[model samples]
Target: MTSSLSLTKKLVNVAMGRESADMVIRDGVWVSVQSGEFIPNTDIAIVDGHIAYVGGDASHTIAQDTKIIDAGGKYLVPGLLDGHMHVESGMVTVTEFVRTVAKRGTTGIFIDPHEIANVFGLKGVKLMVDEAAGQPIHVWVQMPSCVPSAPGFETPGAEITPDDVAEAMTWPGIIGLGEVMDFPGVFNAGEKMMAEIAAARDAGKVIGGHYPNLNLGTIFHGYVAAGIEDDHEGTRVEDAIARVRQGMKAMLRYGSGWLDVEGQVDAILKHKLDSRRFILCTDDSHAGTLTQDGHMDRVLRHAIDAGLPPLTALQMMTINTAEHFGLTREMGMIAPGRWADVLLVEDLNDFHPETVIAKGQVIAQKGKITIDLPSVDYPVWARDSVKLGHPLKAEDFALKTEATVGTPSAPLRAQASVTANVIGVIENQAPTKHLKLEVAVEDGEVSLPLAGGKEGGADIAKLALVERHKATGDVTVGLVSGFGFSEKCGIASTVAHDSHHMLVTGTSEEDMAIAANKLAEVGGGQVVVKDGKVIGLVELEIAGLMSTEEASIVAQKATTVLGGFKACGCTLSNPNMQLSLLALVVIPELRISDMGLVDVINFELIPVIETGK
Candidate 1:
């Protein structure tokens, strides 16, 4: 039970040479994020897990028992921080996500578990908060502000009200209300959304913002007036400029699927806006990306390649993020009174950490974790979240039509072409296209093009949203394009964004049924079925969103799922991530949920087929 006063006293003593430090790193080129300069031949000393002294030589504070680390003239930068992210998107639990990213120089993360919050409500957020507290690095939790994201568009397993937000504000590790995604609710003065924002403001917490609407008119101005502090949903340079102009931090994200940094970083690079108001984050990263590539380190490399100076890019992920969260005195830079989190890198251009230290202890070396992370034991109820009323069949995914020309007893089928409203997927982006395509009808149901039709042929496939929460046996079926599935394959996942329902999309209804049933049997996860055979699977038994298995194992299994998509002729990169978002009804212009197809531009339910037009 060390008090803050006592810790400060110890740090002061070590700085004044009255006490010795626990660890010392000598002779390093310090990348000073505070002054945005690189100082040569600097040393940092740590005491009681806090930086006590940082300047020239610290021989006076060093003792024989103090562990010494020779940086060998390496660039000593602050440990990276991801200001906004979702741990469930990695398909692994918090502990596993930490194990994979901590070694890659990410010492702190701000996680909004809205994905799990939609499933288990506040209890799920508490689960993530408790798990976050045991990590060696700093992990802050944000109370999910949007449960279903958009009300009346989708039904979640649980709902989070303003009462939940006020109650969570009193709990430890809750930094702020997680991204107020309901821009309509905010600008429209919706009571529930206003109350949530009021609770966070009364508690003196930061209010996260998510204004995906590209219109920077009166609506955007009203949204900014609701006391939102930051936004990460911006994709255009103008979007970045508008956010910064409204005194909001513009967070440029580079995720596993969404590559938005290159498109938005020019706000600082070309428009010459102040870089301090801009932050870097990964809104969602998959398990395979964390295991194979890197985490914040990858974003750093990408930012640098986008023509940002190394120190400027490092500032965006470090001090800029810390200041945005009101944690400047806590853990952002290599300064006195801050936590001793630092990274030693030999090259700034490539940005690979040779040694990673957090809270005055060496945790990883050369892209591998050396410290033992604590394992979490999830409750039994979380493991049993996938509750289906009954087993699914091919008929469950059928889209029936009433265009029959004869009676039921002697039904005569007409080869009629109907104008169908399809959810079109744009690669590496969150927004989808509302496409109207003509498709052939057969046997009173919508017919799909045969497998291996041709290169660049029709990519329409059946998309179904099966309710798995209370098991109402409701399956809303629709049509989607841009998966490019040219085989008898189906892909099902319980990792549907915002609601966490079951999403099954494929060319074959029989294979779609198989994929959906397989996930229910294994509890929850993503699975691929090709040619009536199970091709790949990753079992996520925790809250139906994250796996208890190690991240490497999950990554390996997820790789096979990606390979399965390639075998099915879907050439989109990170298609599983795209598949998961098919149920996210927040983004424009179209999406699918358990209710029906959503026209996000109008924020209403539209028919699968265009009738009047």
Candidate 2:
């Protein structure tokens, strides 16, 4: 490593004003992502965190200690880059996130810390930026433009104004403004929202866009004319074509549940649009997907399967993304004066990165990370986030109604929309169903609250959102179905996305209360309880969202938690996914936010109604 650092000195001696290199890889095929072509029998040289040579053999100009890596007929491609993502979505710290993704040959990421920003404000974005700068790979963070995501529609812990964007642009790793999630505000010409976009422009930084609607008339054109550069909200071919035609790079993502690549790849396959205007990203993926599947590597495979050529897939992840972010000169190729980031893959179609290097350092070899990273410390404020106003009781969730005064026996009934708008769980899609279900009323409410099984008991369950941000002492109560939680068990998590609110779901209110208190006792984390006994707990003290713990340690704890859910008969793909989306108010069909039950399609708060009256 010391010799590699000194390599830059040797390169400067060779050519002060010219592009040269210190370390070079001989006998390799370069997957040129810029032109969607592969240059065979090529050599790439690197110096000073930039590529200095990309031609034939460079064995003649080697220094005494200049390290040489023989690609040995393998394909050399620029390291992968994710166009849009959230670091906290992995439930791992930024350092851990980098360490985990390095093994998959991910050299760059465009992250939006908006999830954390909505909970902790500027301090959260700063924390992410600091950690990003320290990483061996590139971690470019975007200043969160929208705090509550939707202003006045919802309330966030802190607000980020136009001034926040200007101030954050001065930060070292602040690449640009984050995804402009407030499309409503932007289309409506809200002064505060437009001013933030202006600030980003004044700073000469890129602006990320998030327009999730399918309407392609005036609103879409209005969004592009407002100075947004790239968008990852394209879920259809037309959506991708429209963005690219309007001079916006269309990002195709395939995360844990969001499968968008297959549809948007049509822009290249069918429409024959400029492939240079497309990029690939995993918008939100968990640790399991990162460890087991891959990071950008997974997106690449899916893109290839979606009918895009191998070279086009590589371009979308590397050169295309780098060009969009204005980092092409520094990265995106094995050419001269670029970062020494390369992936050695035996097969181009599968594109499995066997050896990975960043800044002339071997970070991963054969799908294994070789870097050693230490854990960061969590402050007292971050550790202590869960706070309930008061101990929750069974009656706290009681539904009151007008009862008849003189009836000998009365049916416990109240008026309610029998069929509910259920948030349909699609395996690999972000769009949800506007499902409705009608059921029998119980205790004057439409709750299918179930208790411990085997005996003829109750069929009621409980869902609660504990106030953890400010110790506000609020627990917004609601009902949730389809978890398949049997027996008296409760699942709790502080890693709730977007708001970082405390979400606990259980069959018995007693176990739910116990689990919530346990999470509070540990400052902040995830917990699973059954019959009043602690089943699993993963301590995430940093911002009540992530633990500065080692990825392996956190993953191990999370595995145990999943096992706990299985013990209670919970069987969903990543059962925690269901828990996380419960509080997300952006994606529609149906959802529950901190404000109340939300009809996400209409963006309105709906009341949790009682049974038939």
Candidate 3:
């Protein structure tokens, strides 16, 4: 093992032409992200996995054993970095996620494992940290600040406390605290939230922020004053401007479902704010997106299409992201003393890497991985997480109502129509609309065809949250619209956000029960059932949030699940991604949990049926 002092000395020797460098790449246009310049005919020298020299020529550092590669005048750009993301969102493990993205030139990532933390607690986070350590590229973990996302609003399988945050701060590879999603808790002076923030501050680490509220008033100022550093939830120009004005970096994200960069990039292009304070990331990309499209490369291309200069977009994903995490000396630039993480691309607009190098090693060339990635052997407990008390029946998903519609003394007829609150899903965005629609009541129960008939009708479906963490036979039922399901099918997913409960939605009650039970039988995964038969499934054996299968295979299986949504007549883009967030109670306006239906705007529980109306 080479010591850091010895490595520095060797790097100095190679730079001074006293020793042969391990590798040399000659005659490339250097995309200097630090200075935002494009210099021609630049050559780079690497020794001991660190860059030694980058100047006019590196011929003196080359020896008989030095491996030399001709760049052929391609643009030498720094490897891309995703400053904020979640590995679980891809439905793959850390190793598999890296295998898919590293070939696409994503050399570094900052992941928040709060999704698994909700199910397995701190032990689960340790599992991710251990897996991240073995990856070829940089994978940093942020201690999940909110396990349940919002206390009293929902109950999680496991809970993370301030003590857990402080303990994780001492662990290796922990960059900072995860997104402080409890914005209300921060401004309202909640004890647990404050203590968690204090833990990251005491450890001198970065603290991520998540402020979804659009109102940039006193509450927003209060949230910023709580020492939150950066946020990726901003979806507007004003949102980006306000965050940077408050001394927080604004992360513009372009994921499979959320395409927020087009709206937020105007903060720099239109408002003329400094681009250094803006970073690019993919908050929640599914396996289909990673395998089919790309990772950070996709974000970079999208950012450029949003009217940003090629160099400006590249800087946002590379140097800007690195500087935000205080890792400039280690990675994120094509300069001396930094890791040799470089990408050779022919076209800046397309942003496809012709050659990918990390730590002075050629890992990929021409869109294929040159080396093999080792498989991870997850423990038995992690594989077997979904535990339903018993097989669910159709009755469990029944939305029963009281016999009286109005006051008991002045009760209406038994078959009268009543107003019901519905959780509405918006396309390509995180926030859902709280919809109110009138539905007919028969025999003290609200059934399907709540408003209109099946085809091109109300577009309403039954949403059920089955508590799988504990063997508690609790299934909270609610109503949701905007899925536009026109068939008699049900979709079930164990990848519910923040709290990994089993969320099932369908037009048929029996199919909903079948979908839920099928996932429990397979440990955990996303399953689609139609007319009592399983049509598509992707088994996530690890933590019920990710699969150990290769990313391509998982993406193939997940694609079928997306097709299942289309077959069920749902037309939303990335419907499965939207389905997964229906239970995220922290985001407005309405969501479901194991306890009951949540009104997130008010942080209270209201009846699915408006009582005494």
Candidate 4:
């Protein structure tokens, strides 16, 4: 199962009748992604985890010991591959994610452990790699290149240095460098970023890219020149065309909150770019999406609904992704001498797999995994990562006025109205808006205009980013609008993107403090509080990013959290996803970091108070 040459010899022996075939799939209409046609009456013979023959008939290789499966003339397509994704984002362990998605017509995935890397560094990544290696399905790992994501912007729980990248290049499961989140470093040729890229290049691994809300001209070309290959940050048709035009594979993602596929698929339907250059991925899907609707299967169906041909979408999820990572010879199509990774679906357009085979073994049927997963245990050091330097109190989240702009003679700071910069949240998107609102300065403190703000009015809650890594007890506070809340409620999480700090938003400072301290007391996880009472909590004991709980259990807990959000009078499809990205300094508009408010576009720290300078 490791080497192609080893499996090829066994396949040849089976075809020559020197060895008995282990499995044979009979009478299947081959969904030939290789030829772009469905060839009828295709029979596949497999032996020792490799396909021996794929033709009209395979009676020659059949033996008394061979296990036979009658496909009933169904379309046999290649197993789906999630080109780019993060297992930790599912809020479940690696095993839990595979167990949930395998039955949904997805048999392979390429995972980046950057979320864990930001929490526990190399040791955390090794835990995920080891777990992925033991899964029944095909799981590949990518070395997280940017642990802090953007240096000088925020402090992460851990740091991945060049030496770490070089060592990871030699690991058994490392695929390539994970998405280069440090776009500033790549464009400016930072030494650390360049050394990490050089290590991946020397190891002959593919490099992944992350370019969110970027200009699509020379800067994009500069990033391509730095050896980055593919990107999944595209959310529009023009974004798709931009990446393909630059000779980089454009990864159109359809995660839980990210709805980029519908808008970007027009590049192929209307713009008519080479379909080969487009790929489908789920960069960050949550557990509820996988357990309820589907995984890559859902992505494919949505693509077709958006006017992409069924076969074309399948190609993007299968062969295009496989070829991009140099894994075409191993798993892309249902061809001779390749791994027996096939999905028998009743219909091509609907894409519901009745059976799934991984490495010549039937692992899932319908929507349930039949095989057992690996028994991997995380070390004790991986847990208890939420180190709050001191006990957080309600007063810590208060935003006090420093100096106000008023008359030169009667300069009383408390009497002036200060215009404060706020982080504005967008529904179903990653980027936020920088809003300027004038607030009354009372008792030398900038207080929120909570009386006039309601569900439809211009009211905002206080947002706080608590430093949980160094126990420095640095709490940076800012105002953020967009979570339309009419009640006293708050939510907190350690799953903050890239830097993985503790982000809390609340209408009441007391409720926000309660949620934050509750999560800190549980080591690390997510918590929701309504009217100063705990409503929902999910304990992600592993690095504060992932839970060892079963996928269904975590989904149930998450559902309760969503209910709490609704009860608090805030109604967004995926408010947690929007809340989690508030600390992601890489995205555009404005974000909160440990250093203070960050203007992501300018890549500098701006004062929360406008000062009108």
Query: Of the pair 1 and 2, which is ahead by TM-score?
Result: 1
The lDDT values for all models are 0.92, 0.76, 0.92, 0.88
- Candidate 2 residue lDDT tens string, 531-580: 88998878777766776766678778777787888887766667675677
Alpha carbon deviation, residue 592, candidate 3 (Å): 0.6
Number of colliding residue pairs in model 3: 0
Better of 1 and 4 by lDDT: 1
Q: What stretches of model 2 exceed 4 Å from their correct place?
A: 1-21, 397-424, 449-462, 610-613
Query: How close is each model in CA RMSD to the real structure?
Result: 2.1, 3.9, 1.3, 1.7
True-structure lDDT of candidate 1: 0.92
Full-model lDDT, candidate 3: 0.92
Q: 1-613, model 3: which lDDT tens digit per residue? A: 5699999999999999999999999999999999989999999999988899999999999999999989999999999999999999999999999999999999999999999999999999999999999888899999999987999988898999999999999999999999999889999989999999999999999999999988899999999999999999999999999999999999999999999999988899989999999999999999999998999999888888889999999999999999999999998899999999999999999999999998888989999989877677888889888998999999999999974666778756768788899999999899999999887777778867622343435778999999999989899999999988878888899999979899999988999999999999888989999878888899998888999898899989998898898888888889999999999988888999988989889889988998767
Model 4 ranges off by over 4 Å: 1-6, 413-416, 451-457
Writing each residue's lDDT as its tens digit, candidate 1 over 415-469 gives 7667799999999998899999987778778988854565444779999999999
Give candidate 1's error at residue 553 in angstroms.
Answer: 0.9
